[model samples]
Target chain A: MSNMPTESQHARGQTEPSHGAVRTHVISFAIMIVLTVVAFVMVGAGMAPWIVVPVILALAVIQVGLQLYDFMHLNQRGHSFPAFFITSGALLGLIFIVVLVLWP
Target chain B: MEAQPRLVNAADRMELGLETSTLEGRNKVLGFWVFLGGECALFASLFATYLTLRGQTLNGPTAKELFHLPLVGVATLFLLTSSLTGVLGINAMHQGRRRSLLRWLGVTVLLGLAFLAVQVVEFITYVGEGFGFSTSAFSSAFYALVGFHGGHVAFGVIWISILMLQLKKSGITARKAPKVFIASLYWHFVDVVWVFIFTVVYLMGIMGI
Candidate 1:
């Protein structure tokens, strides 16, 4: 085990402070909050359904992407299997929704 | 050029995070991800059901009449903030800061509890307003989808609380790190689901579509 290269050596340069990570998370949080507020305001303002619906749905998708990639660490290295699993599941789920909703 | 030595010291092991330091730990993380995938599909089916039947109020209160934007907006803030705190706990775990991890996880549990409390109140209000689960197809679907998400949040709160106790006892080790990491992933997944719920159910419902 001692002779094998560690992931940290290859991926992370050194044992640095977690401030950078904290900053990244805080920034993500800010962006999510802004997206959420925008969605809420658009709806509360009684905008046309045609414009509000698709836009809020898009915002939701963006927020979920941020949660998955940033908060869940899917962007990190050595996560190919995890990524594949989630993406496939999401794709299947999307198909289910579309097919089921459009059936009638 | 000479090859660099590949000796993994304690610091390296710590930096790699005990969760992925060993084959077992790595497998545990992978398996949890698979489980999350299954959960995603499960929730999606519920979402589909809800979307299909959302307009069948059948004399009961419509979603626009039933849902209060301010309450739901507050609940979203709680869950969203909880998600951030949960990740911070994981970050602290990676840093080997046990106390920080505990503190952040504790805050997460509180936020989760707050979210649940808000949900309980919201449900009560709905029931009082004749929006019971059996009132109509729309109500049934709404409760099923939203209730399931609430159940996940409840489970996450309990799960993280128990993990906190274990961490306090055994400290953060390879065996426990994966457990903590997996729980956080589940929490984040729950939050992700809520994003859709708020958008599709609450926001759109308010729009009367």
Candidate 2:
């Protein structure tokens, strides 16, 4: 029983966020905005259609990462359950989409 | 003394607010994230339906034809900015700055309203352009996927508004902090979904598959 991890370890004051961490959020928001604009420009520029699709998709994925990590603080500890469930949901959603769309 | 149940020192309170300090707050906060995960799956199914049905305009204006770049761009900007403001609201919550939190949450809700307003205009415009709900399979799918998201935004706006009112009426004590914090999290999740929608639906639609 002594070897087991204690819940009190995660209790108050243990996981308090540092004061300087807000900068990462500001930087993340800037990057997301820039990426979104780049995407809009890439499409509106009338470049090769299907070719640009991947670029925009990649950009969208990056913005999602920023949202999850920077803004939502999924980067912090104690977020494993939230991360696990959300990722599982995303994976399941992907499978459902592939099946539904690819089905004849 | 009103005999506060848990008296976290003021300095420590900012860092470890209601959400992380109390057992109920921590549990509910984690539980809410899991609940949102289930919601994500629900939206995923809708997205799949939309993906399959898109571009099958069937004598209607196609996506490349109907999606106005400027309007969607505006909507996207509004949503992303709302996400930023939500982060600010959380920062204020962590600082125990009640007035700043209220201001930020108010801005967040206003941005949400703006996003919804733009969406309503977009839908109305699309309908006027002969892309009404029953126009085609693509129309139905677009409305369903995007409207579901819009429905969520509407609900979040109402949720945060009520939370804001509560905070204003009752100052930032222990109990109200967690509710406000959780509502901001909900708002952020909505913004994340908007990011995907902007990319997959509007931008990709403009690309015409």
Candidate 3:
């Protein structure tokens, strides 16, 4: 517990974020908007369900990765436990949905 | 654990922002992550129920008939932008800029409110078209899943509003930082779920699948 500060200092380096940090966030926001717009446009154009469904689903997964890694800072050091918990929970939920929907 | 003697003031030791500067704060964050994990399973079950029963409309208005992509798309924009603002708020908190944090959080809360208002209007419009919760199994499941997510957004709006008042009062201390951080985490989780909701529920629903 006493050594926590030094560990955090080493991980985070500084209290103030650099210009690059802010830029990364802005770029991430841009990517999310692009992904969202693409998904909406594809669906709105009346594309085939077989293509639209899988493509939009894949896009959703990619956007979620951005949220988790960039927006939520799960990419930061010392997030292993947090990542573990969320990943396990998401996986468990996925399994639950698959099992229930497939066999019910 | 014995209380360690403070050689420096608590605020001065905040090199990693106030949230991770203390053992207690770190634990609070960790504990909240655990709670979010459980939330995932909880929402997943509701999603599973919706997926299975969505085809059982039984003469009621179906998903294709009920969902409007333009409206839902606008709502998604609101929430997604709010999430961006949320991360910016956390960034301000890390920079020790209290006013920036408050302003960003205020934007987040307002956007959340806007999303909820759209949802309310959508629900009301559905009911006007005889798509009430009791209309069919599909209607029930739809409301149960989407409404639950809306309920989370509403709760987040309220929670962040109160936290804003506290941040105004205390000006972002170690104690308050974790609260704000966890609240932002919750807000982000809600947005993540909505990503799925818009993809699985609205878009797919509009496709008549």
Give the worst 10-residue stretch by lDDT in candidate 2 chain B.
B5-14
lDDT, candidate 2, at B11: 31
Candidate 3, TM-score vs. the true structure? 0.92
Off by over 4 Å in 1: A1-17, B1-16
Please give the CA lDDT of all the candidate structures. 0.90, 0.83, 0.89
Query: lDDT (0-100) at residue B139 of candidate 2?
Result: 92
Best-to-worst order by TM-score is 3, 1, 2
**Clashing pairs in model 2, backbone N/Cα/C closer than 3 A:** none
Q: Candidate order by DockQ, highest to lowest?
A: 1, 3, 2
| Chain B vs. true chain B: TM-score per candidate | 0.92, 0.91, 0.92
Best by lDDT: 1
- By lDDT: ranked, best first: 1, 3, 2
Error of 2 at B98 (Å): 0.3
- lDDT (10s digit) by residue, model 3, range B91-120: 999888999999999999999999999999
Residue B203's lDDT within candidate 1 is: 97
CA shift at A28, candidate 3, in angstroms? Answer: 1.0
Residue B187's C-alpha lDDT in candidate 2?
85
